[model samples]
Target: MLNRNNLKVWLKSVSLVGALWVANSALAESPEEKGLRIATERKAADKGWGDSIATTKMILRNAHGEESVREMRLKALEVNGDGDKGLTIFDRPRDVAGTAFLNHSHINEPDDQWLYLPALKRVKRIASRNKSGPFMGSEFSYEDLASFEVAKYTYKYLRDEVVNGEKCWVLESIPTDRYSGYTKQIVWIDQSHYRPQKVEFYDRKRSLLKTLTMSDYKLYLDKYWRAHTLSMVNHQTGKSTDLLTTETQFRVGLEERDFEQNALRRAR
Candidate 1:
């Protein structure tokens, strides 16, 4: 017969083994669930931004290395729903003053984009198919201007690596949109903060086409994290664009009324 002390020791060992098994199982999640978790994390990072205003400077460099700079003051208002909507006004340059960019996104449909150029004094709908094209002669595509929602793509954990001196999780993302210019994307996200540090985009030919670097991240509203500088480099064209967000203010009490089509004309 087994002694009482031996029986107690055996039970304790089994309990420890069961606890470890539960922990290991929790670490292993389904692919879809992992993708959703990543999206949820990204959404949480920007949760407090009901509205915002900012000044932006866009610098464009051509393949021949020619540089052009544009400065603009922006008033942006955002609303949350099944999707999201944002309206931004551009106030700069003698000719493009009072220009406006309106964006409306739906989980089911391609994002609807409209640009009102003061010189034309008319609103032009930006075609959804043209999202892959350059934006105003800049390296950034029209799609880049849209806010990144996690639902836009599916993600897979590729590996773990070090980026910018921090441990990071390397993930591969495939855009669900059939018209997306990129065939696939590789992103490096900081492990601790879950912030995207870098992304490499592949063209339809499955070639490395462009790279995006995000830096100068700051915490807004003590909860939201924002990248102050974003740079896009086009490998094929040898062109690039630097987007510097000089100012950003959140929760400014902006309303949906500020995002209407009619409001675009009167935005400035």
Candidate 2:
């Protein structure tokens, strides 16, 4: 009952509808898959920043508004097939001077961390269970300082929103480590650069515990991006800590040996 022209028109419409359906199906991304993809892309973008040395100032503010400041230097070395290693050496504050902290991050596993106390002349290993504790009386826990690895958390894409006037993708990440201090974290990552703008940490009991905001981002080596200021606020305690980076040098040619435990003791 169909003429040649009519048959051709009918076939074209069916083909068009079929193509559209296929395109829509291909475009649909599950929240979990989308989250993982974003995290992977972010991690990939930050790769190959060989090594770095940074001098930072730590400002601790108590609930009463009292403040104390400490100066420190950090050295970091990128590792292959694993997370990076870092060392933090304190230089100011007579009581805490010569103190050092060493960290070896691992994906989806408990990190190896140590704190070298100059007064005791001994290095204390930070137990996985205690990683949730405060870092030098600051709002940042030991776990909070670990280098982010994609496998460390299971992520879900929450939504998209504007943060600090920049469009961002909101994600919820649950820690994979049993000893992690935070049960989950809600993160806001800039859509353009994949840089984290803010993160809200939930305690083991799933209560909102702290919020960390990173600002003043600067690009280095035409590739890497770094935040000049990081502020962590404790919701329940009304306390906060601000980390201000005074200077940073990348591609310092640091080697793996420099991050060894022995090197932690000899850190200047």
Query: Best candidate per lDDT, number?
Result: 2
lDDT of 1 by residue, 51-143 (tens): 888889888988898888867766655545545677766555556667788877665578777888787789898767547887667888867
Residue 78 shift from truth in candidate 2, angstroms: 1.2
Write down the lDDT of every candidate, Cα atoms only: 0.79, 0.89
lDDT score, candidate 1, position 117: 79
- After aligning candidate 1 to the native by TM-score, how far in Å is the CA of 130 from where it should be? 4.0
lDDT by residue (113-195, candidate 2, tens digit) is 88888777888987664578887778888788878889889999999999978899999999988888889999999999999
For model 1, the local distance difference test gives 0.79
What TM-score, to 2 decimals, does candidate 2 have? 0.89
Cα displacement (angstroms), candidate 1, residue 173, comes to 1.0
10 residues in a row with least lDDT, candidate 2: 127-136
